[model samples]
Each structure stands twice: as structure tokens, then as C-alpha cells.
Target: MRRYLRLYKLFVLQYLKTLMQSKLDLAIGIAGFVISQASGLVFILLVFTQIPEINGYGIDQMVFIYGFSLLPKGLDHLLTDCIWWIPGTFVTHGGLDKFLIRPLNVFFQIACEKFQADALGELAVGAALVSLSIARGAAELSVLDVMLFIVAVLAGTVIYTSVKLIAATFSFWYKNSFHIINTIYHLNDFAKYPISIYPKFIRIALTAIVPFAAASFYPASYFLDRSSLAGSIGIAAAAAAVSGSAAYGFFLLGLKSYDSSGN
Candidate 1:
């Protein structure tokens, strides 16, 4: 474990060096994400202007959910963004060869390859909006609430990563599953709103299948006192564990079939 941590530190340092060498690119990436988040916020504002509430959820509550979603999304994006590369061009281009030749675990090596600075934008905007929700008297959190919030966020992050892994692992067979991964990941956008507003099928799918609702709406509902703490935190943790285990199993199966471009 110590050795693994040391190697991860090295990976982080290398990425930092690369970022320092491309400061302008880093700035653009961060700014681009920040602007994208700002645009989403603007859309939410426009939405509330047209409708007084979305399925009994007030603007403040909806915004709280939106902001809460970003916390887990940004945390996952920062750490495991490299998985995006796998389904994009890495598998087809034989990039896994380099990792396979090393003694380290392939998934660990791939995940640690990059540190996404752009995610800082998401984190910044998310924190600001959640704080804004509190300022608007949307919710009051006590010490225990804060602790549970942290646990919820961590579990949510795991769910995001596990979902990405499940999508990206398909690249082992399809060679380039970028479209699949992109389509699946974008579904999280729906989680930014109240799931109750959606149709029964979509609500069930999000809650039980993709389970992005566990990451955002459910946890946010707890904070807003719109749902039970047991249901919120318990459901989130359960989903994370189940999905994470399933994703890892799928990844192992995929790795077993990995042939590289040579095969």
C-alpha cells in the first residue's frame, strides 16, 4: 500500500509538471468548465421564472440539488477523468500497452494518469451555489448533517466513477465506445432536477438502474428535509457499493479479454 501511494504521488507530480508546462491550456480548460457551469445556472434561473415550482420543488431546492450534484461529479471528474480516454481513443490506439508493461495495476495506472484542473471550476461553482442555497434559507445543517453530507458526497463520487468504469469497460470489446460512454455520462444532467417531475419510467430507471438520483436528488432531499436521512444516506451508500462492485467485476471481465492492437 505504501508503495502504491508512492507511485501515485509520482503520477501526480508528473501531471503537475505537464500542467505547469501548459499553463495557458490549463487556464482555458478551467475557464471553459466554469463558463459551462454558469450557463447551467442561468438556465435554472430562467426555468424558475417560467414555472413557480417543479413538482413542488422550489427554485431554491432545485438549485440546491443541482449544486449538490456537481460536488460528486466534480470530485469524480478530478480523480478518474482518465477513464474518459479509454473509450475515446486509448484502446484502439493501443495505449494500454504502456500500462500493461508496467508492474502496477492497470486500472490504478490509468486512473492516476491525469488530474483534471477543469474540475476545479465545477467544485468552485458547486460550493458557491450550495452556499447560496443556505444563504437563501433553503436548509439548515447541523454537525451530524455535515458529517453525513460528507459521506454522501464520497459515496456519490464512487457511484460516478463506477458508472464511468462500467461504460468505459466496453471499449475492450467494441474498441472505441466513446459514444456509449458519452451518452451514459450525460444522463447525469437529469439528476440535477427533481426526479419526481419526470415520468414514472424515467424516475425508476434513474433510481434503480443508473442510480444518479442517489448521488444528487436523494442526498439533496435529505439536506432539504424533504426525505428521510436513512433513505437518503442509506440508499446512496447501498447504490455506491452495489454499482462499484458490479463495475469492478465488469472491468475484470473486460481486462481478461483485452488483446491490445497487436492481437
Candidate 2:
């Protein structure tokens, strides 16, 4: 564990050095992400202009959920987003052969190959929105609420990573699973609001199939005092544990089928 951590630190340093060579490009990318996130929020604001609330959630609560969703999503994007490149770029272009030859874990090697700086913009915006909602008295959190929110965020990050991993693992057979990964990942947009607003089938799909609701809706609902604390925490934790374990197991299984490109 210590060795891996040290190696990851080294990787981060090397990645930063590379990024520094193109600082302007990095800045533009981050700025683009910030603009994109702001646009989404603007769309939400426009929707609320026509209605008092969506379901039982007010504008502040909805924004809180949206911001809370970004925390875990941004963390996953920052840390494990390289997984998304695996199927389409790495495997298809034989870039994965280099990682397979390394002494380190292939997944670890892939993850450490690059650090996404654009995700910092998402994190910044997310924090700002959450702070805004809190300052407006949208939710009054106790110490336990704060602690549980942290846990929920961590669990949600794992859930996001796990889903991406599972989708990427499909590349072992498909050779490219970008479409599947994108479809599943984009489902998080629905999770930014209350799941109750959706149809029963969509609700079930978000909760049971993709489990995006577990990553944001359920956890944020609990934080906002819209759901039972124990139930929310339990569901989020269990979803994280089950999804993560299943995804890792699937990845290991798929790894056994990996065929080197011999490049």
C-alpha cells in the first residue's frame, strides 16, 4: 500500500510536469468545464422559473442535490477517469500493452498515467453551490449529519468508480465500450433531482440497475432531511459495497481475457 501510494505520488508529479508544459490548454479545459457546469445550473434555474418546485424539493434543495452529485462525480473523474479511456483509446490502440508489461497493477498503472485537472473546476463549483445552499438555510446539519455526508460522498465516489469500471470491463469482449459507459454515466444527470419526479420504471432503473440514485439522490435526500437517516446511509453504503465489489470482480474476470496487441 505504501509503495503504491509513493508510486502514485511520483506519477502525479510527472503528470503535473507534463501538464505544466501546456498550461494554457489546461486552463482552457478547466474553464470549459466550469462553463459547462454553470450552464447546467442555469438550465435548472430556468425550469424552476415556470414552477414553484419540482416534486417536494425547492430550488435550494434541488441545487444542493445537483451540487452534492458533483462532489462524488468529480472525485471519480479526478481519480479514476482514465478508466474511461481504456476501451476506446488504450485497448483499441494497443496503449494498454505498456501497462500490462509494468510490474505494477495494470488498473493502478492506468489510473496513475494521468491526473485530470478539469475535474477541479467541477469540485470548485460543487463546493460553492453546496455552501450557497447551506448559507441560505436550505439544510441545517448536525455533527452526525456532517460526518454521514462525508461518508456518503466517499461511498458515492466509489459507486461512480465502480460503475465506470464495470462498463469499461465490457471492453474485454466488445473491444470498445465507450457508448455503454457514456450511457450509464450520463444517467447521473437524472439523479441530480429527486428520483420521485421520474416514472416508476425510470426510478427503478436509476435505483436498481444503474444505481445512480444511490450515488446522489438517496444520500443527498438524507443530508437534506428528506429521508430517514439510517435507511439512506444503509442503502448508499450497501450500494457502494455491492457495486464496487461486483465491478472489481468483473474487472478481474475480464482481465483474464485480455489479449495483448503485441505492439
Candidate 3:
């Protein structure tokens, strides 16, 4: 574990040096992400203008949910999103062969290759919206609530990372499963709203199958007092543990099946 951490630190430093060569590009990417996030918020505001509320959630509550969703999603994106490229470019083009020759874990090597600095925009926007919601009295949080919120965010991030890993792991067989990975990931957009507004089947799929709701909606619901603290936190923790274990197991199975292009 110490060796892996040292390797990751070196990888990060190299990536930072690479970023320094293209400062303008990095700035532009961050600006673009900020604009995109702001546009989504604007669309939500327009929706509230048309209706008083959706499924008993006011605009502030919706914004809080939306913002909370981004915290985990952005953290996953920042840390592990390179997993997405595995299916298309790495596997198909035999780039993964290099990782197999290295001493470090392949997944850890992939994760530390690059950090998505642009995700900072999402993180900043999310924090701002959550603060705005609290300032406007959308929800009042106690000390316990704050502590649980932190745990929930970390657990949610684990869920997001696990889902992505599972989706990408299919590349071992298909060689190019980018579409499958993208489709699975796009489900996260639904988590920005209350899951109650959806049909029973959709709700079940989101909560149990993909479990995006555990990452965002359920956690936010707990924070807002719409659900019991124990139930919400328990579900989130269980989902994270189950999904993470499943993903890691599947990844190991896939790794055993991998056939390097040199073979």
C-alpha cells in the first residue's frame, strides 16, 4: 500500500507537469464545465417558474439534491473516470498491456494516470448550491446530520466508482464497450430529481439495479428530513459495500480472461 501510494504520487506529479505545458487548455476546460453546470441550474430555475413544485420538492430542495449529486459524481470523475477509456482506446488498441507488465495494480495505475481537474468546477458549484439551500432555509442540519452527510458523500462516491468499474470491466469480453458504459453512466442524470416522481419500475431500477438513488437522492432525502437517518445511511452504506465488492470481483474475473495482444 505504501509503494502504491508513492507511485500514485509520482504519477500525479507527472500529470501536473504535463498540465503546466497547456495552462490555457486547462483553463478553458474548467470554464466550459462551469458554464455547463450553470446552464443546468438555469434550466431548473425555468422549470420552477412553470410549476410550484414537483413531487412535493420545491426548487430549493431540488437544487440541493442536484448539487449533492454532483459532489460524489465529480469526485468519481476526478479520481477514476479514466476507467471509461479502458473499453474503447485501451483495450481495443492493446494499451492495457503496459499495465500488466508493471508492478502496481492495473486499476490503481489507470486511476492515477490523470486527474480531471475540470471536475473542480462541478465541486465548487455543488458546494455553492448546497450552501444557498441552507441559507434559504430549505433544510437545517444538526451536527449529526453534518457528519452523516460526509459519510454519505464518501459512500456515494464509492458506489459511483464501483458502477463505472463494473461497466468498464465488460471490455474484457467485448473489447469495445464504450456505449454500454456511457448508457449506464447517463442514468446518474435522473438522480438530480426526486426518485418518487418516477414510476415504480424506474425507481426500482435506479435504486436497486444501478443504485444511483443511493448515491444522491436518498442521501439528500435524509439531509432534508424526508427520510429516516438510519434507513438512508444504512442503505447507502450497504449499496456501496455490495456494489464495490461485486465490481472488484468482476474485475478480477475479467483480468484473468484478458488476452494481451502480444499473445
Candidate 4:
């Protein structure tokens, strides 16, 4: 266990070195993040202007959801963004050979390659929005609510990684597996809103299957005092276990089928 932790640290440090070497890329990424946040603000204003309340969720609630959604996603961009393109790059260029030859875990190595500086803006904007949402409203957070919020963010990160892994694993057969990743990310956008607004079938699918709801909605609901903490935690736990297991299993299956193109 200690050995594995050391390897993970080493892998992350190497990525940090690479990121530092490319200051221009990091600057561009940060600029893009700021633009995206400005756009989000405009979107929120437009949305609230039309609907006094959207399905019992006010603009403040929407802010919480939007903020929570971006935080983990940004962190994912920083840490595991490389996993997003592993499928196309590895299969097309036979890049998996490098991972296969490495002394450390391949997943860790792949994860380290994705070090996006845009995540700094994401983290900053997300935290700012969350605070603004809570403070602007009369809603007060108890200790338990804060704890549940933490769990939900952790769950969100796990779900994001699982989805990316599943998408990348498809490269074992389909060289264009990044399309699958794109689709998942598009669907995950709904997590920026309350899942209750969706049809019952869609809600059920998201809560029990893909579990975009568990990542943001559940915790947001808890913060709004509309759901039970126990139930939300239970669902998040189940989602994390099932989705993560499925992703790792797919990766293992893909590993067995890996054939280097010697590129």
C-alpha cells in the first residue's frame, strides 16, 4: 500500500514538472476557464429572468448545482484528463506500449499525463458560486449537510473517472471510442440542474444506472433539506461501487486485448 502511494506521488510530481514546462498551454487553459465561467453567469441570469422558479428550485439552488458540478469536473480535468483521450491515442498510435513497458501501474501513469491548468479556474469559480448561493439565500448549513456535501463531491469525482474509463476501454475494439466519452460528458451536463425536473424514467436511469444524480443532485437536495442524508449517502455509495467496478473491469478486459501497432 505504501509502495503504491509512493508511485502515485512520483507520477503526479512528474506531471507537475511537465505542466510547469508548458506555461503557455496552462495560461490558455486558465483563460478558457474564465470565459466559460463568464458564460455560465450569463446563462444563469437568462434562466432566472424567464422562470421565477423552475420546478421549486430557485436560482440559488441552481447556483449550488452548477457550482458543485464544475468543481469535481475541474478536478477531474486536472488529475485524470489524460484518461479522456487514451482510447484514440493509444489505439491509433500504439501508445499503450509505453504503459505496458512501464514499471508502475498503467492507470496511474495515464492519469498523470492529464494535468490541465483550467482546473484552477474551475475550482475558484465553483467555490465562489457555492458560497454566493448559500450566503445569498437564508439557507443555513448544519455540520451534517457540510459532511454530505463533501461525500457528494467525492462521489462526483469517482463517477467522472468511471465514465472516462469505460469510454477509453472501448478502444479495445473501436478505435474511435472518444465519441463514447463525448456522449457521456454531454449527458452529464444535466447534472447541473435538479434531476427532479426530468421525466421519471430519466431520473431513475440517472439515479440508478449512470448516476449523474448521485454526483450533484443528491447532495444539493440534502443542502436544500429536500432529501434524507442517509438515503443520499447510501445511493452515492452504491453508485460509486458499481460504476467504479464496472469501469475497472472493462479496463482489465481491454488490457487483455491490447495489441501494439509499434508506432
Candidate 5:
């Protein structure tokens, strides 16, 4: 276990250095952070203007959701670098061969290659938003609430990573099928708001079928004192387990189809 962790650390350092060498990568990363903050600002302003509150979701809750969403969203982009190339190089040229030769897990190697340094800005913005919301909103949050909130967020990360892995794994059979990935990206829009506000069907789909809610909605709601302990943790935990298993299955199945470059 320690050896694996050490190798993973080295992988991360090498990838980070590669990203640092590229000016374009730095620009894109910063751009992503700026765009996220700008979008959050616009949403907050728009929601604040139209109705003093959105279905009883206070500005603070909304901000908390915004901050919550950006963390995994940013980390996914930063850490899982090969996510964007699922339908392209990985599929067409069998780019995954390189990883197979490495000692580390292929998925982890791909993730390391796709580091998101620019998300530093998003992390900063999110932390600031959370602080501001706490200052402006209610105090005296219980310790349990904080713990549950952390659990929900961590679970959300697992769900997001698994979903992307599932999407990427599809490339094994279908070349250039990242359209599915794009669709998943669109679905992420719903996560910015409270899932409870959606129709029962949408809520169900987010929880059961797609599980995007496990990423931000449940966690943010838990933090804001909206979701029940049983429901929120249950959904998040189920998503982590099920999606992780699914990703693993897809990966093993896909490995059967891989033809090394020399062959």
C-alpha cells in the first residue's frame, strides 16, 4: 500500500511538472476558475434579484452549493486529466497502451496526466464564498452537521470520478463516443440548484439513474440543514459503491478489447 501511494505521488509530481511547463495549460486552468466564479456571481445576482429567496433556499445555501459543486468539479478536471480524451486519442490510437506498460493503475495514471492546477483559483473562490456565507448566515452549526457535510462531499467526489470512468470506458467499443460525456456535462447544470426543487422524476433520475445529485446537491443540502441524514448519506453511499463497481467492470471488460500498438 505504501509503495503504491509513493508511486502515485511520483506520478502526480511528474504530471504537475508537465503542466507547469506549458503556458497554455496555466492559462486554461485560470480561465476555468474565472469562468466558474463569474457564473456563480451571475447566478447569485440573478436569483437574488428575481425573488429574495429561491424556494426557501437562502443565498447562503445557494452560495454553499456553488462552492461545493466547484470543488469536485474542479478536482475532477484537475486530477483526471485524460477524461477529455476518451473518444479521441484513447480510442483511435490506443493511447491507453502507454499506461498499461506502467506499474501504476491505468486509471490512476490517466488521472495524474490530467491535473488541473488552475483550479487553485476555484478553490480559493469557494473557500471565500463559504466563509462569507457562514459570516452572513446562521452560526452555531452542530458538529454532527459538519461531519455529515464532509461525508456527503467526499462521497460526491467518488460518484463523479466513477461516472467519468464509466463514460471513458465506453470508448473501448465505440470510437469517438464522447458525445455521451458531453451530455453528462450538460446534466451537471442541474446540480447547481437544490435537487429537491426539481420534479420528482428528475430528482429520482439524478439519484438513481445518473446520480449527479451525489456530487453536490445532497452534500450542500446536508450542510444547509435541508437533507435528512438517512436519505442524503444513503444516496451518496450507494452511488459511490455502485458507480465504482460499474467503472471497474467496464474497465475489465474494455481491457479485453485493447490491442497493444505493436500488435
Candidate 6:
């Protein structure tokens, strides 16, 4: 484990060097995510202008949920962005061959292959908004509550990684599962909101099927309402464990079918 951490640090340093070389591209990438998030925030503000709250959540609460959701999603986007390539061009063009042959874990190599600095924009905005939410609310948080908050966010990040991993692993069979991956991954957008606005079917899909709600609404609500703080965090942790285990299991299964450059 120590060796893996050392290698990961080295790989990340190399990637950072390459990333810094392209200043214009880096700025554009960060700006793009910031704009995307801003647009969502604008929509939320406009909606609140028309309605006092959505199912008991005020504007501040909405911002909190949106920002809370971004933490895990942004971290996942930064660390595992390379997984997208598997279904895009890697499998067909032999880009995955190196990862397969490497002595390191296949998932680790893929994760360390690239880092999306653009996600920093999301993280920055998210932290700012969550702070704002706390300023506007969350005034009674205790030390233990703060610790649970950290646990929930970390678990949510795993859920994000697991979802993406499962989607990318399908490339081993589909050769190009980018569309499938995108469709399922974007469902998390719904998770950024209260989830109560959606119909029962959609709610169930996010809560039980993809379970993206666990990464956002469920955990975010923990801060907003302390009625079930520990319970909420537990659900988020459980969701991460279950989804992560399933994704990893699927990834192993997918590897069995991988034929380098045979796609």
C-alpha cells in the first residue's frame, strides 16, 4: 500500500507537470466547469424566485445540496476522468494495453493516467457555496457532526468513482460504452437537487438503482436536518460500499473479456 501511494504521487506529479505546460487549455477547462456550475446555480435561483421552496427546501438549502453534491462529483471527476477513455478510444486503439501489462493494479494505472485539474473549479465553487450555506444556516454543527460530514463526503466520492468504474468497465464488452456511461452518469444531476421533485420512479432509480442520491441529497440533508445525521451518513457509507463492491466486481468480470486492440 505504501509503495502504491508513492507511485501514485510520482505519477500525479508527472501529470501535473504536463498539465501546467498547457496553461491556456487548463484555464479553458476550468472556466468550462465553472460556467456549467454557474448555469445550474442560476436555474436554481430562478426557480426559487418563482417558488419559496421545493418540498421544504429553501434557496440556501438548495445551494447547500448543490454544493455538497459537487464535492464528491468533483473529486471523482478529477481522479477518474481517464476512465472515460476506455469506452472512447482506449480499448479500440490499444491504449489500455499498457495498463493491462503494467505490474500495478489496472484500476490504479487507469486512474493515475490522467488528472482533471478542471475539477478544481467545481471544488472551489462547491466549498464556497457550502460555506455560504453554513453561514446562512447549519449554525448548530458540533465537532462530531463535522467529522461525520467528512465521512459522508468521502463515501460519496467512492460512490461517484464506483459508478464511473462500472460504466467504463462495460467497454470490455461493448468496445464503446461512452454513451451508456454518459447517460447513467448524468443521472447524478438529478441528485444535486432535493430528489423529491421527481416522480416516484425516478426517485427509486436514483435511490436504489444508480443510487446517486446517496452521494448528494441523502448526505447533504444530514447537515440541513439533524434528525437522522448518523443514519444519513450510514446510508451514504453503505451505498458507497455496496456500489463500490458491485462496480469492482463488474470491472473484474469485464477484464476477463478484454482482448487488447481486438475491439
Instruction: Tell me which residue pairs clash in candidate 6.
Output: none
Give TM per candidate.
0.95, 0.96, 0.95, 0.92, 0.89, 0.95
Off by over 4 Å in 5: 22-28, 138-140, 260-263
lDDT of 4: 0.79
Model 2 residue pairs with clashes? none
Q: Give the TM-score of candidate 5.
A: 0.89
How many collisions per candidate? 0, 0, 0, 0, 3, 0
lDDT, candidate 2, 1-263, per-residue tens:
99999999998999899999999989998898788898989988999999988887889998999999999999998998799898977777778888777888988988887799889989888988998999888898889889998999999999999999999999989986899999988989899888888999998888778888999989988878657866687788999999999999999898888886766
Model 1 TM-score relative to the real fold: 0.95
Best by lDDT: 1
Candidate 5 — what's its lDDT?
0.74
lDDT tens per residue, model 6, 83-185: 8888766776878787777788988888888888999999888888899888987435689978887888899999999998898888888776889899989
* lDDT against the true structure, each candidate: 0.89, 0.88, 0.88, 0.79, 0.74, 0.87
RMSD of 3: 1.4
Off by over 4 Å in 4: none
- lDDT for 144 in candidate 1 is 92
- What is the C-alpha local distance difference test score of candidate 2? 0.88
lDDT of 3 by residue, 204-254 (tens): 998899999999999899888658866688789899999999999999898
| lDDT digits (tens) for residues 1-263 of candidate 5 | 79878876887788678877897878887877777687867878786987767777777778877777766666666667577786677667778778888877777677766556787777677667766777778333578867766676677767777787777778778777788877876687788787768999998888887888877877676667755766667778888889888888887788789775453
Compute the lDDT of residue 244 as modeled in candidate 5: 80
Worst 10 residues of 2 by lDDT: 225-234
